[model samples]
Target: MLKAILIDDEHDCVELMVRELARNCPQVQVVGRTTSSEEGFRLIQVLQPDLVFLDIEMPRMNGFQLLEKLDTLPFSLIFVTAYNEFAVKAFRFSALDYLLKPIDVVDLQEAVRKAERQHRIDGRQLELLKTQLHSHHLAEKIAVPYQQGIIFLPVNEVIYAESDSNYTKLHATQNRQYLLTRTLREVQEVLEERGFLRVHRQYIINLEHIQKLVKGEGVYLQLSNGVSIPVARQQKDRLLQRFGWL
Candidate 1:
């Protein structure tokens, strides 16, 4: 059984979560529960649980602050919060699991299963997550599902992304290409804000890698990697808008 702890500010939340864990996730055994962040911190040091269902908001210390206090973390944290838009965005980029309050049992179970699969948590990973959450910076890496495992690549190395039917192919700086099961649309949702522009329905090019733009009846983009992709006739305006040319 996975030893776990719950740390929330609300008494009702603590009660509900305990019930949920008992009813839904039998594999997780609740070793401790506390409504105080300070007490929660102390419990973690004493019990040293394998999993922690952490609440993001507390009276004295928020979730990030609590994490900063723990110098050594051996457990996986599944954050529970109401709506932390900014933090959630960072969490998605960092590939961290979080449950939104009014938490669904399905999502809770999924997080538990994921935690069980990844048995140990690295302290540095927690630090990275804290950095991503606290700073106005892009996530350090992105995870791409490969054959039987996931490949974590630095976000800066991405040169462009190509649509491979249903799968998206990630073209990186080192002449590496990874075919991801995720659709181009899904990849765009993650990469679009990070200086990537969808020049065509089939291609999303990295803005930083544009070598030159040749104007014609239709515009064409030459990438740093020596490949040119056509800008779709309809998306031409949106593409040009990136350079303030339209």
Candidate 2:
């Protein structure tokens, strides 16, 4: 059985969720429920449930703030919110799950099933999601998944990435280029914090490896490896902004 916790400011809602979990989701056992974020955080540290049904709004500390305080999140989260337009949009964008207020039994059952399936498929997906969520607080490091095995690369080693159809080519200062099966957009999403900039539609260059910018008749980048990359007209302004020139 999956241990779970229900956190909400409304006592009635918390009771309802607990009852629903008991009735609909036999696989989940409610370890605790609370209206206070502080108490909820404490319980989370103690119980270490398999999942948390978190409410986004609460006095003193909100749900997101509670998640922020955790050094290492102990469980997967299914956000429970009444009405927060922006928060809902963010949840969808981040590919996380949430249930709006006036929760339906069907929705609750579906959410629990999805969470269980995710846990069974790859336990590491939860860890990856947590890492992606709190990556800002982590030290700079890159783990590139490969067919042979995972490659641990320091963020500083990557010089640039170029799109090749559905794959991306990673160029590093070690005189080796790696072909990854990830799209350019996915690569951009993961490497945004490591000073990577898209100078063209097909190219993402590491700002640390840029030797100089040649902006004459047509803009081009002078890389540390003596390779010149043509900068697209539309992306030139954004590239300049990346260097704090704008």
Candidate 3:
């Protein structure tokens, strides 16, 4: 049996999760439950469970705080949250597993099964999940509130992203530039895997569009469309290494 724990501030939420675990996650034997992060931390250290169903928002200490405090993460964390916007992005960026509120039986079961499979894999899944999440979280995507929302921009279409004060400007193919509400850091996280290289703190360029590297004049890059992007002196060597020139 897989040892497990449930941590949530709401008693009803905890109870509901416990019931679902009992019914669907037969492989998991819940050894502890708690509302306080302090208590949860103690239980985790003591129990050393195989799985932990955590809630993002809680009194006194949030789930993230609890995670941050752990000397060593004990088991697979399945974050439960009612609000899906901010927390979801964080979890996705961290490559951590989470379930949205009003938890569906199907999603819950899948999450449990994934946890069990991950446990068997013994760290490989964790690494892969982290990689995938990091990539997914950084991609240029828009989550509009309503009316056929959520637009995902293909990484290939992106020429470069520039920081605009608090926001970021996405320059796509065909000279189309879009003003995004998100910060450049967030955009960097998603595009790093898709050949988006941060040549400078304020600019991230698409590697696929690079046509040629001009050795002199600060190592400027000639794009496929004949646009030249100035490559920072520090970034030249790394870019060469990335292209297997070194």
Candidate 4:
């Protein structure tokens, strides 16, 4: 069974989830529950639970504040927030689990299922999430979760990404290529803000890695790694404009 704890200022929210966990989730054992952030911090040190269901909105110290206070995070976090805005923020923080207020039994079970699968939380991952949340700088690296472990690739080292049937192939410097289980569309969506541009349906290029642009009936991009990827005719204009070639 997974040892778990709940930290939320909402009395009813904690009570409802506690009851639901007892009724439906036999795999999880709730070790402690707290309505105060400071008390929860002490409980975490004492219990050292496998998982923590943390509420985002609280007086004095919110969820982010409590997370910042910790020197090291050993447990997986499942963020609970009442609004959709915080949900996006949670995702940006690479939160593995997120539950909205008036949590559904199914969502709660799903969150616990993920928690059970994780053996331990990576401290580097927590640090990266914290940096992304607090800093103005673009995220320097993006970690891709794979079957055995995670692949932490420096964003700048990535030359481009190509579609590989259901998977996306990430090509980086030194001729390294990783076939990720996630789709190219998903990868594009995440890194689109960070200089990744989809120049064709099959390819998204790292603007910083472009060596030369070849023009013909269509266009082709030659990456620093010497891979020439074809650019779709429709995207040519957008690409040129983005590169200030137009």
Q: Pick the candidate with the highest lDDT.
A: 1
- What are the runs in model 4 whose C-alpha is more than 4 Å off? 12-29, 64-72, 82-114, 146-152, 163-169, 177-183, 214-219, 244-246
lDDT of 2 at 125: 30
Estimate the lDDT of model 1.
0.81
Highest TM-score: give the candidate number.
1
Candidate 3 has a TM-score of 0.51
lDDT of each: 0.81, 0.74, 0.71, 0.79
Tens-digit lDDT track for model 3 on 72-177? 6647778788863544554443335678888888879877866765552223323433444445444343221111222345557888888998678878788866
- Candidate 3 vs candidate 4, TM-score winner: 4
TM agreement with the true structure for every prediction = 0.72, 0.50, 0.51, 0.71
Candidate 1's residue-wise lDDT over 120-198, tens digit each? Answer: 5555455556776668666768766455445678877888999999789999986999887557886787788888888
Local accuracy of candidate 4 as per-residue lDDT tens digits, 85-200: 43344254353457878888887987788777665566566566657655644467876555565667788889899999978888888888877655688677776878889999
* Full-model lDDT, candidate 4: 0.79
Per-residue CA lDDT of model 2 for 1-246, tens digit only, reads 999988899999999998888888999999999999999999899998889999877999988778778777646678888755444433432435679888988878877876674441222333333454454342344545444433556668888889999788888886868776557886776566567888788999888898987878898898898888888989867875766662
After superposing all C-alphas onto the true structure, candidate 2 shows an RMSD in angstroms of 8.4
- Give the Cα error of residue 63 in candidate 3, in Å: 1.2
